[model samples]
Target: MKLSALVPLVGVALLTVVLVGGCAATEPTPAAPGGTGDGHGHIEGATEMPEPQLRLVTLDSAGSLTAFDPATEASVSLTDVAGAELLTSDGRYAFAAADARLTIVDTGTWTVPHGDHSHYYLAEPRVVGMIDGGAGAGLGRAASNAALTAVFFPGSGETVVLDGEALGEGEIEELARIEGEPHEGAAVPLGEQVLVSSPDAVQVYSAAGDALGDEQRCEDMRGSGITSVGVVFGCADGALLTVEGEDGVEFERIPYPAGATPAESFANRPGRPDLAAPAGRSGAWLLDTREREWTLIRTEQPLLRAVAVGDSDGRVVAIDALGRIVVLTHEGVQATSEPLLAADLVGAELPAGVVLEVDASRAYVNSPSAGLVHEIDYVDNARLARSLDVEGDASALVEVAR
Candidate 1:
């Protein structure tokens, strides 16, 4: 295991850590057990630290926007965008997409996880505005559980539903917008209800919109995330699983293991239930979701991005296919890194704002054609834990208040 090198956060183009909270623990950030918003876990001005204060919110390729501090690499700029190109976050709002246009930024910092402890806050990062989203959009926020975020456009089936306590007081409020039938879809917010993804059924709602019916069939429901043992949707033939059950949102499909090959997307580290996708070229596809099972791992090369750092050495942080940074587990390939995006590997294609992000220890990887941001220490075997220096082209990485 041995990992603690931590010093990869250079001049910064973007970064986020913000753990903060170590004292005020009365446990109040729990309203969305049914899901909507009753407290974005607490945010009125923000400034309550004692522990986690690590932040990094980068986004470049000309859309600038910083916020560093991998541990005193101190940085801050936070605003700028002209054609963003995809960057999403729920660890405290970062969303930067650029085609269907979505700009919100507010990395003031956050962490709200009130089960036994966790409250962190740090306010003063601005720019929370913009949203035309509906042409492929696809979000599903809840990094640390700050309820009610889901975006999901799917070229316009529309499911916007924000209002995680009015985005923690910066405001965007729209607790529901629901609509369906547009295909290429997927949605999630399963607490007060909201599942969406209809062409085989998945629908279910009521974050203040009400509809709660369809109970999981998933035939083509594109990708989706949010985990802690629930809300996963990526079905062409498998994976539907929702959670909040008290006679409400509860589905489960999981299929696909025979011919396998179905993980268009899914990452982890946020309320992880062990998920890491990209099993196409025969590589990483962990997906444990509390043992629903699906462990592929393969990787000889051909990955581009994989996360799932359910640490303690279950690590699975890939980026192979010549871009190097491959550190898997389940007993195979322990470390490798030297290509570092090997000039963004043009052959298999790699740009959708490539990311690798994971945190709780380290694993940032985002070279953007060599602008810098490696920082991997995946149990020290994937080692390199430093290389941050980004002034431009980190392309779009999200780490917000992790």
Candidate 2:
């Protein structure tokens, strides 16, 4: 059933993706040698998909993890994570966690950018394995790159690094586990070392669990993102960019302007230089990692979630306090959508899992109240591109496969 989008005043051209069924997702197509290996370098276990297709992976309140393909409108059950409370992904793999364990899942869908072009792949999605340890193994957000995936547990002050290639083979091999004093922090997998962020300093560690030199001091460091140029970590006063080049690892801190509220975390399209985050209630922060500068885009209404699209138009998609999806440009507010989640956000406290997720072309916001993921075309007047229903409630959502 293609339900009408609750958009007032604006007429939306709604299109429904044909579902294999309504909710029950069991199996996916078996893995085969896809011809996608034609021109690009080959990946051992994966079949190259024809082109890049966005897949939304969701972890419901009950711990059911399912992958929903927007193009085929097919939902496939990957696995169930017991007591799963959080879900974070690095394009190909999703790290889900309960208080004491961190689980890694392979969505079987991925993309690799080759120069200006890119290669896509699809396999049978399944659970890789779990990282069992301390009180909260992966409570902190996880970050990854082409080679490694780092999971940090602030409660235990432990950072675990997993080989990306091993993950592709459905393994939970731990490359290293570095220990630190318990504090809110982040760990990013860069080149051959894992950058572990303590409460105030970021240090580099090798796979053999040895600390390297050149520790960076950033007060209240939390979030981290891996871009094409380097790794970015959010700090109390500003943002820190760490680049590993021919010379060595270099750190550059972009301090926020005086009296500015620093971002609690940052998010954007993976592998991009620019990142975005929510600043207070009425502003969004954009950090241009390339130029090493920060730009704050202010909005009139309160914002709950913000993501930098990093497009040619400098488009920034954000969700306002009133449940409207607003699009912002360099000049300011470019457009706004109708109050889609007004009831969901009208309460005194925001719900647990609703978030704004963006890709190359569109942004998606999951409404647990509606059990559907609304696709927003930020470049097109914040139009309701479409709404998709996955297997679970979509309490927690992440986009993969480019």
Candidate 3:
């Protein structure tokens, strides 16, 4: 046969072979680089991961932990820890009271400020560890710069200070455990020294349990706050301020005006220079830790909860008796949000309160009756940004950066 005729024969043979091979042989299709494909051609695990954002931690009535990301409006249910309360954060870790144990949770996100801007990162959020905090753990405070945390057990009258970094790493080591009269003492961790409340003074102790110096006179010390300048304890007559000096730690008693009503307690953001507390029925006390000055700001209505925001303008935010969120600056009421919670529940035993998170751009107010969390933009006229309806009775909320 001619070559042309042979070409037709070869083509027919090739087509016949391909048709037969297709029917006889079958093999699985390969998957994409990091994904497996279904029979219908849908690929799994091909989508991009979620970006890191600021998150809020809530302790529900059912004793479960919930992490909510405001940016994506997503929430995940974390493990449950019983009897958890007194939630506090150091921007990176959250310390909660779980009966006689202190439960530490990693927020898995953190921000680093650089000049006017900042950088944010994400990590794994988890329950890092726990510490035996004894009974009636009333206060949970963290000192970020000093890498320390103090938990006050009112029932035991013991203040337990722990290594912050170590606690976050799942290692429980007490820097100091000072015992005092039960239900009448408090403690603050100051670098190598721990300031503890005694019967008639604020006592200092080294991390190794040795007394540092003579106790500073602070009769009937009740409330304390940490600022950038130092740690302050409110007394019957004045405030005891502790600062780091060249030679050693320095203590000063900044007495209130001779006739001024004593400020029995105060509240301030961690590492800020300003502290705020209720002066009396209708007045608010502002303490400047850096200048050792006190300014009394009068409010038309009594405040149920007040927190110093530590802004440059000496602004403070307070919730009045009617569930109104009011922002006050030196010039007076900058803005006030409408009643977000039920006015009748103001003085009730409900787990309802406002938490002004440290160095946070927004404030979280929990309404247990409504099962909602109202997010307020503090920098912008105290605007009500949005509300998140969380599961369970949202008793406490804390914002933390990983």
Candidate 4:
């Protein structure tokens, strides 16, 4: 089947005509009698072709962001923002946090979900806007429920949350400017309420900065991620799971097992409800928000980063100090990848910069030390597919599907 060419409309703000590739009007060629046509007519057992499956967004050490389309082997440089690191996406827009600014890039692609399949579209991608997050801007996160994006500055003890509508309209509207003690803090948007980190708890505030409900106890909160079930925050004792209830918001603390060392941070798959973190010296923790269960899986290697993927019986993809990728489930180690990153390098320079981007079937591991991204087919026993030389030191990597 022939795909249609993307034609950009003139005088439009990064807009393109949305057209299906093979849906153009054309005359049907005559088919041979009593025989199936090769290319002129409908063939038996034909299925809808899959669109370009994924795109990789990389933030280089220099803070330049580039979106690479592997299907077309095309790369688009979005912007150069200094000190950029954390990259988060809501499957629509990419929010990259630099030193004191939040750069928003329009991915120019999105997916519309159907029951069994999804439709993909693409347009002219561009750097939509940039928000001055003030000094020490870092930890970036996005929430789809309230169409909000947040950036927290640990050095300044300030958190900035922006409304999605304002962003789409090329305006930066601060939903909340929260000030608190200087510590590793995080924020999450829940409709009209914003959750900001306090010294000993998580405090809720209105978009207009008015205090909402009483602060929820969560000592030394650090990492956070949103899932379909709710918003979760990792604390000293355990994790705080918040969900929308009939009355309002319901909060529950899923304590770590007795005597289990507390994990101060957590990371979850973009849309999954399960979260993973480093439990102890050699243990990986999994928290299922939907089930309200926490499971500790022991690992032989000391893990540096762990991301929970898959549904029930989900797996945790972690990178150890030796730069090896380990896939573990609740049972045990499921699969392991060869050391794709350099194990040497010391102190802060250690190839400590590693990011895992995973989808249903594959996981993309980026190693800045090697300047390469190893694509692994997770379902096929963690078989390495391709080691793509991205040709730069990537501090962050995120997978975008269209």
Candidate 5:
């Protein structure tokens, strides 16, 4: 129930939370009342409702996005998603598309979009990847290695499967095109079918574009303000999971500790580019769709945006407004309190070369003000493991791999 009790579950120890329930018990200013910025509007009976899912999508104020290899910790990329308003991952690579071309950057390669015209770079997607629809609609997930792309373009109002590998080199072909709007569609390897969702419906399809005839429609969800297609485990209203069932789509909301605010409100920071926090306020609500009943995960940090790394067993990492990094594990939230190396782990004065690169990892901290990249090693509670210097304005750090 407290920070100390949460240590073992998080795989980290000794986290000191100064404030418990002791501060002025006064309600949070509606501006400051503790709640997620999902744009779900205040619910009258939400006070007694269960906590839903907690999914944090973080972004950097420095005009960059965070992409990580949740599997190996060996790779991470802080990319510029073509000045995208939001960044969401299919748990493997990061997606940023502009115009008709959807650029898929391998976190391992950290390839930059070149010349604004080039198509095939040295970088490659691992499975199936595709960019559907245009801006303000939704972007579908791409499986790096697969040759297919699960896409939904608003113009067509359908989810299309195209040969991703065959897309660039003048050999474009549509393998399967199913009927649906380009709300927000993410691919999940559910045996032989792909589950896709719009703001109003859920449709299941075969890998080869065959409609499985399984559909779940929600009549009451007309303008829930959720415009994006649903991922395997996407976000929903108030710490809940938006699931598709035989009957219809169900919102399995959870119940957590909710704090109310007074008429005089306070906000953490407005216009933050986080999926969990959105653009209006601070704080985030994370929901794990990978699980059946979406579990509500809460945090105090101002999450900007996030990238779900599939390589790391569906691990998700987020960056806060202050450029701090927080990772999601099977248990709970674990923050990088120290740097990367054992020597620079914790309790040591932050040495030169250790700059937290916006919101990637404490392992690589970049202080543009100082023009240095500190190699961080977070051990006990300290943030810097070891600081190392790098080139550039420290303006941005992208994973450039060979």
Candidate 6:
């Protein structure tokens, strides 16, 4: 494999390993029959639009949000995305970052549409809101519910609150601003609360902006011991946060040794052995208060600057730094998607490369230099989709309803 374009990609494997095995007990439903159709012929409750199938959306380097449909493996919608850094979903609206450019598309039209409602939802897509990331700084993350949407800006160390429907295209405002720099972290939304992970601590916050008084501080307080964080993670309430960390993480507070760093905390025994050569700059982590335990999950090396983990067809999809995309599971990591021509995904025309965003069962990869976004179906590890001539370096991605 090409090494230079690969190192930065694996740097995120650090703490992502901790997230793999802690999901709550939901009796696994029998796997759906193979092939694209729901097998119901017309899906039960056909009139109600199937529980929004997840569609991956990514920003091409040229500043456009390319919506990739995983079910049929195609690009359903293409919207202009400028100054977008983060993307998240609640199965309803797709929230983009600071630019306040929220692109809403009907998830139904992307794949097999059962009835006429799918066409109506798509013909008049909604431009929900356009809100600033607080003080004009870019937004790093966003979380939402039926009533409101909360946008977080790590650069400004502030959270901007907004009335979900109040702001739309051409309208902008500075909502409530919360305090604190979200240490190199990943965020998980818990209905009315948001969970954030930092090198030294994990803090919870209320939707109304109150700290939950529960602080689970890590053994190592020093930042240096942490190589990279926010890889991948597993959390309760069906939540997960994955970040990066270093090898042999030894934190003094963990009783390892005085002055031991987080990475030094792990000794000779190998925890995650599947990590490849570029592994360690980052990884995954799994935390569960109910179980009162934290487990480290290993991953391929040189992870992306950030990644969104998703499950589909009994597999996990990962989008790495170089934009290289892959399908992974307990068995192993498999490169199943076609590489993109870098010139199509990024507007500035950098060398061809690939990065991806996975949700539900779809993986959307972008090659900024090639101005293209490729959507892959993890169910069969098939190259089911492709989009061309995209613009902007896609900074983030999320699967949404429409």
TM-score of each: 0.33, 0.87, 0.78, 0.81, 0.42, 0.52
Q: Quote the lDDT for 339 in model 5.
A: 20
Which pairs of residues collide in model 3?
108-402, 109-401, 109-402, 110-402
Q: 1-402 in candidate 4: lDDT tens per residue?
A: 534333322222222222335553654333423332111111112123357347788888888888877666677887787777677776657778766666788676655355466655565566777767565645545544325666566666677777654554445677778777777777777755677887678887777777777889988786887776888888888889888788677788888788887775677656677888877676688888888888988988767777888466678887766667788898988988776765433542234346677776678877676676788876666788887776467667877753
lDDT for each residue of candidate 6 in 1-402, tens digit (9 for 90 to 100): 211111111112221222225543655444433332221122111232334544556655455666655555566555665655556544445655535334433233222233443311122234444545445444555554333456555555566555433332213343345666644343444434554455456566655666766665542322111111221222121122322125311112212123211221110001111111112344332222223233333555433322323222123454444444555554555554453432343432223223344444455555544445566666675465656333345444555553
- The candidate scoring highest on lDDT is 2
Backbone clash count, each prediction separately: 23, 0, 4, 0, 89, 95
Model 6 residue runs over 4 Å out of place are: 1-47, 50-91, 98-123, 134-136, 145-148, 162-176, 186-188, 196-199, 218-314, 319-324, 334-355, 359-361, 381-397
Rank the candidate models, highest TM-score first: 2, 4, 3, 6, 5, 1
What's the C-alpha lDDT at position 15 in model 1? Answer: 23
- What is the lDDT for 42 in model 6? 22
**Local distance difference test scores for all models:** 0.72, 0.77, 0.67, 0.68, 0.36, 0.40
lDDT of predicted model 6: 0.40
Off by over 4 Å in 1: 1-89, 93-107, 110-147, 150-163, 170-193, 196-201, 212-216, 219-232, 236-260, 264-276, 280-299, 302-317, 320-336, 339-355, 358-398
Q: List pairs with backbone clashes in candidate 2.
A: none
Per-residue alpha-carbon lDDT of candidate 1 for residues 114-177, written as tens digits (9 for 90 to 100): 7787767676788868777655654322222446777765666677777665565567887777
Worst 10 residues of 3 by lDDT: 1-10
Ranking by lDDT: 2, 1, 4, 3, 6, 5
Encode model 3's per-residue lDDT on 187-209: one tens digit a residue: 77776677787756888877666
Give a tens-digit lDDT track for model 5, residues 1-402. 111211111111221232335554654333323332222121111111111111112234343544333223232334555544323333224454444345454332221112342111222233223354444444333432223446544433556565433432223466676666544344432323455556555566666877676465532121111112222233222322344456544445433234411011001111111223221133333333334322224456544433333223333354444455555444545654432322332232232222222222333444445544444333223255544343233433332211
Model 2: CA > 4 A from native: 1-45, 136-140, 346-349
Worst 10 residues of 1 by lDDT: 2-11
Q: Give the better candidate number (4 or 6) by lDDT.
A: 4
